[model samples]
Target: MSSPPDPEDLTARARIRDAAMRHFGEHGFEKATIRGIAETAGVSSGLVRHHFGSKEALHAACDEYVLRTVRKLNEETWAAIKEGDLAKASATRRPSGRYHRYVARSLIDGGASELFDEMVGMSEAWFTGFVKGDGEPDVPVRDRAAVVTAWGLAIPILFEHLSRAFGVDLSTPEGDIRLASALLDIYSHPMMSPEEAAAARAGLERAARRSTTEGTST
Candidate 1:
């Protein structure tokens, strides 16, 4: 079967959208302008407006584009994992890196809660598939997935901090490898033992129950 069309085409409209994404990521929604995005895309402001109406409308288009791209990348990753193809899964980093900064910034930009929630919902479905037993999981899939999604979002959002700590520019491949190496060390060494984790979970549950009770009592 033929492969699906790549979304990052060289068309004028795609260029404008990509430029707008980068601008919005770097400058945020309030500061980024249609004219600036047009200049970056090598198009006229009028053309940008012609293609996307207004800045708000253009941003909405970007939201749609990024979500679609992320969904595609997520599927590729899961497929690679299922096939035990480490090389293929690792390759996703390159294409995804191009948009990583934008996604990280976009999440915190106003009105992106829908995007964040959609990502959580997407991960929840995937986590549910990993449930091996018919019995209840120790943690609910939605809760677990939401936390994991937030953690994933945090990496790019904290890129500058990570880069400064490592003394390397993480946007580059070498710095990425350095950070990944440290992360490997971290993953290899679990911070908490199973006993500690069980204890923590119990404490958290108690705290949650107490908070809920207090809220309902008022």
Candidate 2:
């Protein structure tokens, strides 16, 4: 007869999974190793394999964990904004902020496309509701906006060098608040009036037409 699952086995597996996610986020999937993750988790390499079967499977679990964390963050952001408190809704680096750093690095390393897509999909669903006016932008515009938003959020973590140049340690709470305030200021203010925006678009269209005509003539 088969024996039942051990609670200790479950605990060890959870520890391994958490450690693998941290390693994958920090060093990336290619550079992270089963032995390294096992060491970080304080478990044996054999235990890791027994629990996850392979490094690829462990990476998959890490991806799912990232996705779930993102979804929870999204929900919390929405909740705070619904209460009319944007400041409260702003993304804070978590207590175990290593996960956040890992995510940022993973995106920069090009190993988190699935996470990016899931976020964009979630944003599209939320923003689609706001497109009710006569001048509502289409899917392509929304896609580009979402990508820009993702980059804006990722750049600070992805390129810590830039933060260093600015004399700000973004890993600290003070620096995070400084950056958040600046971003909030920009987002709250209109960059241009509608008339100014329309004029800018017209100028761009004219330039585009000229370029096309010049190409055709050549």
Candidate closest to the true structure, highest lDDT: 1
Candidate 2, pairs of clashing residues: none
TM-score of each: 0.81, 0.75
Best by TM-score: 1
Tens digits of per-residue lDDT for model 1, 4-103: 5575566899999999989999998899999899999999999999999999999999888878777777787678768877456555554657777777
- Tens digit per residue, CA lDDT, model 2, 144-166: 65875686656536547756765
TM-score of 2: 0.75
- Which regions in candidate 2 have their CA more than 4 angstroms from the true location? 1-10, 91-96, 129-135, 138-141, 162-168, 193-196, 211-218
lDDT of each: 0.80, 0.71
Clashes of 1: 0
Candidate 1 TM-score versus the reference: 0.81
